[model samples]
Target: MKKKIYIYILVCTFVFRIISPAYISASTVYYDEYVTVSYVSDISGTSFPSTKTSYLWEGEHMVYKFQLSEPTIIKAYFSWSQSDEVPGGIAWFSKDMYGVDIIGNTAAISSKNKYNLILLEPGTYYINYSFGKRGSYKNAYNIGLSIAGQKVNTNTLVSASSWENPNVIRTDFYYEGFLSNLQPSAHYLFSVSSKSYVTIDYLFKQVDNLKADSAKCTLYYRNGRVIKSQKYDTRDTSKNKIAVLLEPGDYYINLSDATAPTSLYVIAEPRTNTLTQSIKRYTNKDVTVWLDSSYDHERALMVSSKVTDSNIRSNTVWKTSRNDTCLVIEEDFFTVSENGWYTVRTEDENENYVMTTINITNIDKVPPTTNIVNNKTYTSKSITIRFDDDVSGVKSAKLNGKVINYGKVVKAKGKYKLVITDQAGNAKTVVFTKK
Candidate 1:
């Protein structure tokens, strides 16, 4: 019997050794990972009510500490029971050194609170948790911890800013998922991608309720590098629209309106360019063209038809419904002088401008060359355009102010022809002489 007892004790010891603890390791953290919110407590019972305990509230804020070895990109996410009552909000973060919020509202989860952390350097960080500006904090909330890409069982904590008498943690009660910080009529999310340009689209509201008075947007890059800005006023609540020019890299965008409305939604898409900028063509006659302009100003084009006001006719041969980086300059017949100068004026909406001048006598004075070979007929409404050479800065072709797809039939004639423009706004059009 004593021998049997000894063998049983040995077996118990082996079982204990094989089973690991519920909590994972203490050290050995990886880079670029995601963490979620795990534990939450409402101390004040005001903003974070017990009724919303099991589910995450949009107003509840939490903080967490983590160590980093090197600069890393951290993407954060959240897991919770999806409930019908919770409205969505934004997530934010701050470095551990300073208490200031360096990156404000980096990501917004209007429908889902999941977010990606803004890029951070190697060191310790204490993330700021809030449901936006909607409600106040009533108690303490906890966020889940993950390092180097592994989720571990560790304690997350939230405390009042001060522990003195009348120590208030701003803990308040709230319904599940209510984004208290999001303004009813002015709420928006601004995302500036690696390539500085910003794209904003509406979200989370009816089509008509979202409208802006000025349609003006601004972007901040490399810690306050201001770029180009523009203004527009329209009721078109479409999918996505580009805002303005910015330097290439990460940035922040802000959209605002003078007149307040109801609910507003906005998002930013990364700036991308598939074409390069260059000079497209030069008129044999005297004419100067403005190439590309920096984000701060508008490119200009000046033409000296040298025709009398009575004889010279002016028209917008080509204008883009969508903004184009490169365009071609085109004008109808203009009598030129042997030693006269034709100029193109490039000016932005802001009234900033530049000018380019060409001397008429310089070139072998000749009109833009063309070829009518392998002539194709228009079965459907279409027009054909042939270029002399691979024109510089003529990245795209447009007809009647609308961008035309390459190899697609353009259904227009005469004044409505294939117009090309350079980045400098030097433009040209190949008028279709109807057969």
Candidate 2:
């Protein structure tokens, strides 16, 4: 019996050694990789209360970290497939280092899939998720993570900044913003080529009854002119939608709080129509395209800076039809390679081709190159910067990383370090001290 006990102990030790602390080394992925999500915490109580598979807590925030060796492009995006509740908040880096939120409520997986392809110098980066203004923190639903080493700009409606606060919004998708003590206002920008209806779902989740004027949201024009306003109260539990009928043009959304912070989600639903193809094209500085909508068997012609209107082949189609062909641009819409003169050709079932000329006027996507005209002529007050190429507009001009107001400094100055970012999102940082 003593001998048998010793043998049993030996067997137990062997089993423990084989199974103890298994470690999987990080693999070097050269190509793209759909990153599977593993739940770090089990959902219970308010820690995370939702039917969704993935989620994040408000204050602690869910940190999803991924690592890849060797320098490559990192394409990050999330999908809330078939879920009733989407993230009512923000999805950016763990800390706001990028100065831009990767995704937000109004700009999640709306009508199209959107991904931000950033080239990170090989290391581990955490993609953080959390709820923002509204009280929708405890639970978020249907979050998917996608990653790749190449550019994946396939989303149509990307989130943009609000006028009053930093809340991001997508004209085509939906977003939840807030008006609280710290941030008393929320803003969004939308445009329509023709008449369309707008909807704002204000979530009224309050403990006690409040006065009428305590909370309000107003729709306005791009230039800060009010179009209309609506009021809500704490007693209201239903998502009382404030709908507006407006003519074709540009507009903005402004949500404010009279007493306390309130949560509201913004969505723009274009009136549905049978696309029997006498195609009506619509666009603005920021445009939304429902190209992801099911339209197989039907064909669309694409005309841009490279292609002319005369170029039309029956086999031609919209780049958006293919998940990989679309390119994400200013308004988060899948459009041609560049913003310039372009045309789209749509065909009816009757084999008729209707074409629309679209002139995409916007800032230059190219980075500006700087050159000092004269080395002999220089002063502290003035420094002449001649760009290699004329840009649509200079977003910001700086000398030695200091704020140099345009027209304030002349063509005379000390050593020059000129850094400029044009309209197209490209940036150039040149450090040459007025040599």
Candidate 3:
């Protein structure tokens, strides 16, 4: 009975924990009567003056109090110019304490907005400011109060997105962001199953006035070494690739900035499910080339291929792009090189080269000629449909009119409709009825 009661109590406690509300403190107490003002050289504390109105979950705050001589209306603003911090807090230029009528609350004070507090009858007033929390840390902030209308609040008190933010991603996603004065680096945390190859790629939208490795990115394993940028004299800013094996765990990635206010793209996913590969067709778009923008290393054609010892063809080093920090790299396999894989490496030593796999797959719009190639002529156990040309790979095969869920392996014998798809996604169906 005692054991049963203990277990019952445990279950009840768990249930209570689940149902209980999170711990939240009450708002800051308001002054009913006018508060006295005392001048200090500076508000002394680790953080800016924060009250219940402050957004700081963990930090200190500064306080200031002064008298307006008589009743007066004033415009009070928080400026970060001298303080070097963006702050959010409550400030009052007028004291309307005890009056049933309500007053101002804490709000963000920045370059764009200022708080205008009307002192119906100013005897004594207190202007308090504190630091606001940004993300998961409580950092330092210097706040400057500017009283625009009737100059009341002062004394250098201190404190301190969404898709445009460092969004968390689970599966394959392609998101674009910028590195600017506001945000210099973009950070991300992602997950992957154990023993999976994570493929990450980032490219500069505009390759002007940046080095070859100027725009860099790093993928750090949850608690392991991932990858980072490399220093190279050449200016080749082809889309950099990071293909690495990762254990099942969360990982952190930081997109390092090349130049302030530069535009870039980030593509992340498993290696097998990698995206952003351009195709080479027989006509106009035969060769896709990336250019080098620096005049010193001007026009150096950058080329890489699947073959470890790659053979780079088109070798016409041209002039660099205007204000360019990029090198020209081309991926082209003309008629002679019908089928194969191509790739290009970034400057990073540990970085995996960006792969563009080209199977030169059957672009045959027409159905592939097929014949029944099976041992023992006819068999009920299994059947094989052989096409004239080797395909990109097997897609699916069916048995009888009913579909056979044969994976890559082909099996089962009956009226079969075998659909073979090539690299370009063109499908050819072959129907064979086996006894």
Q: Tell me how far the alpha carbon of residue 423 in candidate 2 is from the true structure, in angstroms, after superposition.
A: 52
In candidate 1, stretches whose alpha carbon ends up further than 4 angstroms from where it belongs are 1-217, 220-333, 345-355, 363-435
Please give the lDDT score for candidate 1: 0.34
Tens digit of per-residue lDDT, candidate 3, span 308-402: 32422212212235413223443321222233343332222343223223343333333334455322335555554455434344344443344
- Candidate 2 local lDDT, 1-435, one digit each (tens): 111110111124443233221101111111122133223221111111222234333322334456644333344455555553443333443212221223211223222244333333335555544343333345434455554342112121222225754344545454433232223455666677644456677653331121235567678877777777777654554635666755567777666664222345555544322212211232113332323222221455444434443554434434555534322232212344345654444444545444444555453556766664423444345455555536455567776677665444445435656677765556677655442
Evaluate all candidate structures by whole-model CA lDDT and list the values in order.
0.34, 0.43, 0.38
Candidate 2 residue spans exceeding 4 A from truth: 1-168, 207-213, 237-239, 258-261, 272-435
TM-score of 2: 0.25
User: For residue 358, what is the lDDT in candidate 2?
Assistant: 53
RMSD after CA superposition, every candidate: 25.3, 31.9, 22.3
Report the poorest 10 consecutive residues by lDDT, candidate 2. 1-10
The segments of candidate 3 whose C-alpha lies over 4 angstroms from its true place after superposition are: 1-166, 207-213, 224-226, 230-234, 260-435
Q: Which 10-residue window of candidate 3 scores lowest in summed lDDT?
A: 1-10
